[model samples]
Target: MRLVVARCEVTYTGRLSAYLPEAVRLLVFKADGSVLVHADSGGYKPLNWMTPPTVIEDGDGVIVVRKRAGRSEDRLEIRIGELLAEVEHELGEDSGLEKDGVERHLQEALAEQPDALEDGLRLVRREWPTEIGPVDLMCRDADDGWVAVEIKRVATIEAVEQLSRYLEVLRRDPTLEACRGVLAAASVKPQARTLCEARGLGCAEVDLGLLRGAREPELTLFEA
Candidate 1:
């Protein structure tokens, strides 16, 4: 990650135009290919920012970040007026949040009663193998089609991406060529839901209370 405190001007052009005239601000260029411009007073929010999967072009006193937004492009241009302070840090690979007691218990419950996530879901295996990592559960649906499941207490965009990666690897086999993915979690975040919907991945939020025989489980399975 690179951090710079500078007097700079920022302009964003995409669906909307935003301009920040010359001012002293904090600039962050993350290793994940994201860029952010922050003003001292905005608390945590950046004055301008761009998410990952971006193209960055840096030149003398100027940096531009570009991302594809449908047919057009979203761009952020930073023109440095004066460089105040600069620093770069090598942050190691992130150790992501773990599945706690609740998540583990949720997995055990779902594994025991796979139908609680989707009507036709039948457990085939747990810790299904792949090159990248293990899938939480592998199952067969009503039609006996393979379904790869990733269990999380709170599913995020990362979870959706993880399931996507698993599906990419699982679909290589002729027998599992049609294998799909489902993210079963206690809670699914909205952003993750949107990504899953766009990618044609399944997102199911299981109510532990309802799944534990508190009430008859009515699962809504996404058909891919």
Candidate 2:
């Protein structure tokens, strides 16, 4: 499988140290699990500050997306510094950053990361040129069957909505007779569970404990 490694920084005010750990830890775990990449936050040591994600603050953090792929031309690497500055500017956070605001900004920025396909598995960003719209991941099995993936860092009904859209797009392809659907989230929203059941989609709640060093499971059969 292709792997990418990157390091960024966590900058938050002392007020958020408690919640910051959970957020950052979850972010690291989700990133690593999704991309098969190593992720680290520049700690408080202050000994060495390098690269784009070298700074963050309360309601704000910096992250970079890197890729290790054979097709260098297609591979995309996003510098954390650039993304951080962009997000900061977009959010207009000149003063103290709000936790919710920062989190939302980073999440939106993360969607711009690079993409790579390996071992029948693919890690895709928002910009991948896919006929099936903006897909999070496109998995192809040995039988040449395709599965559409949609991810959620925190559970929300939107996960179901996003995957539902992908399924609709996949249905347009005659080759995709039956496109499997997936919802990977840290927590499962009640509405999402209901939608998954009603729509026959596979839903999985991801956590560091479940995916620390494990590979994403293959989607064997369609639900219902």
lDDT: worst 10-residue window of model 1: 93-102
Q: Pick out the ten consecutive residues of candidate 2 with the lowest summed lDDT.
A: 17-26
TM-score of each candidate?
0.57, 0.38
For residues 46-111, write the lDDT of model 2, one tens digit per residue. Answer: 221111112212223334333222233112122332221111112232343333543343334333
lDDT value, residue 27 of candidate 2: 26
Predicted candidate 1 versus true structure: per-residue lDDT over 1-224, tens digit per residue: 99999999999999999999999999999887878899989577688888656899989999989988657899999999999999999999765556698798888899999987788889999888775567999999999999999999999987897798688667766799899889989899999999999998989998887878778766799999
> Which regions in candidate 1 have their CA more than 4 angstroms from the true location?
107-115, 118-205, 209-224
Tell me model 2's lDDT, rounded to 2 decimals.
0.44
Clashing residue pairs found in predicted model 2: 11-56, 11-57, 12-57, 12-58, 52-81
Report, for every candidate in turn, its global Cα lDDT versus the true structure: 0.88, 0.44
